[model samples]
Target chain A: MKKLLLLLAIAAFCMPTWSADTKNLKYVDGTTLTIINKPQHDGNRLRRINTDKYPDLTSRVRHYLNMPTGMALRFRTNSPVIRAKWTTLDTLRHTNMASISEKGLDLYIKQDGKWLWAGFGNPKFEGTKHASTMINDMDTTMKECMLYLPTFMQVNSIEIGVAPDSRIESCGDIKRAPVVAMGSSYTHGSGTSRAGMAWPAQLSRMLGVDIANYGTSGQQKMEQFFADIICDTDADMFIFDCFSNPSPKEIHERFAPFVKKIRSKHPSTPLVFLETVDREWKNFDLKKRKFENDKEQAAREEIAKVIANDPNIYFFEPGLYTGTDHETSVDGTHPGDMGYQRAAINIAEKINATPALKKIIDAAKAKDCCKSPCKCPASKK
Target chain B: MKKLLLLLAIAAFCMPTWSADTKNLKYVDGTTLTIINKPQHDGNRLRRINTDKYPDLTSRVRHYLNMPTGMALRFRTNSPVIRAKWTTLDTLRHTNMASISEKGLDLYIKQDGKWLWAGFGNPKFEGTKHASTMINDMDTTMKECMLYLPTFMQVNSIEIGVAPDSRIESCGDIKRAPVVAMGSSYTHGSGTSRAGMAWPAQLSRMLGVDIANYGTSGQQKMEQFFADIICDTDADMFIFDCFSNPSPKEIHERFAPFVKKIRSKHPSTPLVFLETVDREWKNFDLKKRKFENDKEQAAREEIAKVIANDPNIYFFEPGLYTGTDHETSVDGTHPGDMGYQRAAINIAEKINATPALKKIIDAAKAKDCCKSPCKCPASKK
Candidate 1:
């Protein structure tokens, strides 16, 4: 039994964190989050679609039956109190809506007598029964615990700040980073969750940079255009792609000027172009197939041409694989959380293309560096 | 064969019209995206991160290459564009950092000539190769086109507005919603993007109600109470999830009266409570999981009791099982986009328990309205 426990622990630690779908899950030492802004209570009223049918109630819940993303519920102060949606990536299928003890509903609260959270008026609602079909996970995965507090202890309103206090204070003078993207709805990310997907956010993590996201949903070049809200900032650059929204004409038209605009501003900022990602083009429309063929050739040639004279400009072919399919979207255009991870992987790869990595690879080729194929350079040390 | 083609076309139409992964693929319509929101520029700066080894580049790319999110070349602007991560949905293997792309990346482009809307920094660089696996039905998802347009077409700035001309639009002056939230970092949608993955964002979508989200990265709960700019008049309710950071003593000592304070102003408004989300219990050291576990439970229960008699004061179970997982995090405590989605789903389910949705369900149950299951009223045609 001792040996078995040891093996389990080792297996858990040594396991490859990344699976076939997303980036490798890194075991973080501690979690940290900071709120830049909190949800504000705006007094705008929705046209209240379908409301006459269910009057006197706040909103209807029927539309959320199967959507993985939907209208999230919040209290007047903007804290999320209730949520409704279609499907979730929760293969454990642990419904947050669970009514504990077959009380049909449960809530959380502080033992000291404050109300922490409450549950549905109809506590009898059982959770979704078909847990197996609800998930997309591994056999080894177990159901994780999630609890709903009983009503008496829930509270409202609080401050927002960081933890463990990373010595680095402040984002520092609102510095901005130049950015470009290429992918599907996952890239453009939709809904009122402005900037939620991360093409704009993750970049902030990598380079301590800020950028504007110009991605759109469900647009594969049908209404494509170059950058809008081009600022006068000296810190602009361009990154172009035609992967998720494959269109020969749009790419054919936008690539050069897009690059030119950034070159016009931050001429020193490195410009990079991207090749299309992979999927089953043949599986879709004939028009898509035709466009894809044209675009691939055009992309390669244009990339070759652009880089021929300008060394600062570069190109990155997507170097990862994603595992979504036609059914990956709640509506097909917007990638759920899974698709967003795919976009991140591809983006991360492009980020890896810096000159430092190139030197590492060259060193590996020469077989003069450390034993590993890739080596980190001696840093500021 | 003709009949088969017709059938195939019909089938495609019946399928969800959008997919996050399948950009430019087959859609029921032959024509592509009708210009929803006009395209705009998304830019970022590309400061070479890996300079020592690669001398000319930055270290940003080097770190990216180390992860599984494949690489893609991007253009830079104000900030780095990225796909924020979410907790592992137990359904998809529960590996937080799975490989998202299999082969070369898929490029997505808005239909407009917008300059580098994918974000600013160029992801393309030397040595970034394509992933080996490929997502299904995604070949030719997009085409990378290049062209040197006549000089007249380029511009300096364009606005990426939300209007009918764009994909999303809101009308009228209500300008606000019933509820709002104020919190520390936990309130800010972190580890996820702003548009689609934040819990508040997801909750708003689920409820079809406008929720104001003001989450910042790395904020602590203390900051919310200190925030005093007023936007409180429009709201109908408020909720607070400060427990994500509060100590047990804090929950008992500070949370309850804070809620009552807000209630003093909007006496008619409902308030909800939230338990903090933490993962210390998962791998809780010698310490009993009781502190985190029991406290979370107590908080949820207390809220329920308060709301038991009042229609306005409601409680929600913090967790439930659906098809997804809730145990995901980069640092373990912060919920990823998946976690946020899960949080929202939990809230949404409880919202379904509200008297509002129950009235509809009860009426349907009374008549035994539909086919196999208890039928609810049909959606308004």
Candidate 2:
């Protein structure tokens, strides 16, 4: 008994103190938390679109809806360490993308009125289930935090974990309206290194506004269903990154009708169209160069006709999205982290310059402070 | 007999025009080519270090020597499409790095007196044997080109493929003395997206100088053998990225002697010691923060002592290698492509500022023309 007791004592000493203590951590449903950069869904916090309501949508669109591309959980916590336990729909891996950008979470902390990259939940390669400590050894002061969801992979379930003695609570609903963005892989964060480094996510941080990403990775062909989804959503503005994936014929056939569908519901809302980024490989590939040029030409013609009648419609021409050097892409198509960051900066500058869009962005920036009327301690500073 | 002959004619018509035509292409051994950015090896063009003379070197050092890192084949071709057939020693893949950076090749073409990214030989995932058409369908114009070798994997054999009618010839030897860089994975191009995007590779392109990469990843522990290799190599400048991998104790024990070994042979050569990059993750992880801090402190102390004694010795303090945003890394430890680019620019700036280094770099810039006395057509521009 004495020998056994000695061995047990030794074992207790060797074990990490936090292992047993972590059991005392409180668990909360992700649905109860404040979600940013997502359209209102039917109680499914993990999903970007309400699948039941959009049952008639294509299988690919329905599948991509569960990815939560620009969605994030907004909360306030005094926890020294932030942990996450989540299950991914598929442990997806891309040769050009970092694993963290595909299936892991990115944590940002609001420090001195700015959201800074604090930590990342690096997912494992073999399994769908993942558990990671996002950040640790932080001071136990109440901090406003945002945890960006995986850009490429869907999440089945997720639970934010904190220390036993700490508290985590929702930041409540954001009063400012979101800018709904619909597009293909460029907007879907394909080549970006981290989940939050996606262009839309970067824009949200830059403009201090919510931008709901409806990117479906080569599926944003300006279908009637996508237009219907965009029209149904309550948003301050709409941006289309719809030219890159679809055939030029598809653009000519669907462009006018797609705009009409959205304008029917919210006629005066700011509608922005992004010109397709010229692929770097097209510089050498003659066939691809012609193909991409035709698609852009078609998009420009369609946009010109639509904008002639619509007062609030705006067009953003391609402006050095990846710089003049043409070295920013991973696969000569989709933008990498540097490209995304550059695109976001250029796009944000365009948005800020437009009078109608700038008003909404400024309003959103004002509301980003705690409780609109500026009650938070940070506002005083 | 007529029917058989007709069938053969149809088969010949169906086959690609280049298939049989490529048989006429001249195969040149890599050693005979103008192999830039590599130290003198015992007739082995692919290796960074000559293992025959250094028989007592560590197995890891011997293995890492096979990776080409910053080496490139300088040649000129008028071929519309560039193709490559190569066999890798290992079909290495990292989740964070793009496949093209590890085992594939990157091609850059000189345009209007500047080297522009033209194409890449993207490696397949499953096999060691790889073949790829890097670029296609360009106007037949004589273009000066450089093909960067793989950063991580070893190349067993490689062949450059061109049009049957076109000629590929070496640019002759670079007249300027090369910069020999020694270090760990950062110098080895771990997190960079492409082989040519490695800092040393980028530096070469930026400064128009040959910077020989002697980065041996985790094995760069201030080994005496590495010091001996540095002493033996004919270089104008020597840079050590040797602080990142070694333990503080190992650094304290070996750093002074390592510098001494190099100084013994080439006392006047500009020897630069780089301070390790501050990893972004260390912001939250106190333990790692402390560990890295201690290592940097140790390196600084050792570097200070060496600099005090030797007038030619220089120490470069860590700058913002990955920018202030802290979102530039693929993993928090290794810098991504953007980080590498930033570091290269900063390091190049520091090198350019030093009068002793500036003289060597200016000489290199002058020699980058077709012939030493400004004979190239571009020099007139």
In the order shown, the candidates' DockQ scores are: 0.03, 0.37
All candidates' lDDT scores? 0.32, 0.78
- Minimum summed lDDT over a 10-residue window in model 2 chain B is located at B372-381
lDDT of 2 by residue, A235-342 (tens): 888888999889999999999999999989998999999998768887555556778899989998999999999899999997327777777877778768888888
Return the TM-score for candidate 2, rounded to 2 decimals.
0.87
- Stretches of candidate 2 exceeding 4 Å from the true structure: A1-32, A172-177, A369-381, B1-32, B51-59, B172-177, B369-381
Clash count, candidate 1: 302
Model 1 chain A poorest ten-residue lDDT run: A130-139
> What does candidate 2's lDDT look like per residue over B1-381, in tens digits?
997687446434433234324455655555445677877655467877667778878877887887777888777766766788888887355756777787888888876567788888878765798888788765565677788998888888888888777666665543223688888988888877778887888888888777889888778899899888888899888888999999999999999999888888998888988888778777555556768999999998898898998888888887326667776777667887888888888898998889998898887666664422224333110
**In terms of lDDT, which candidate is strongest?**
2
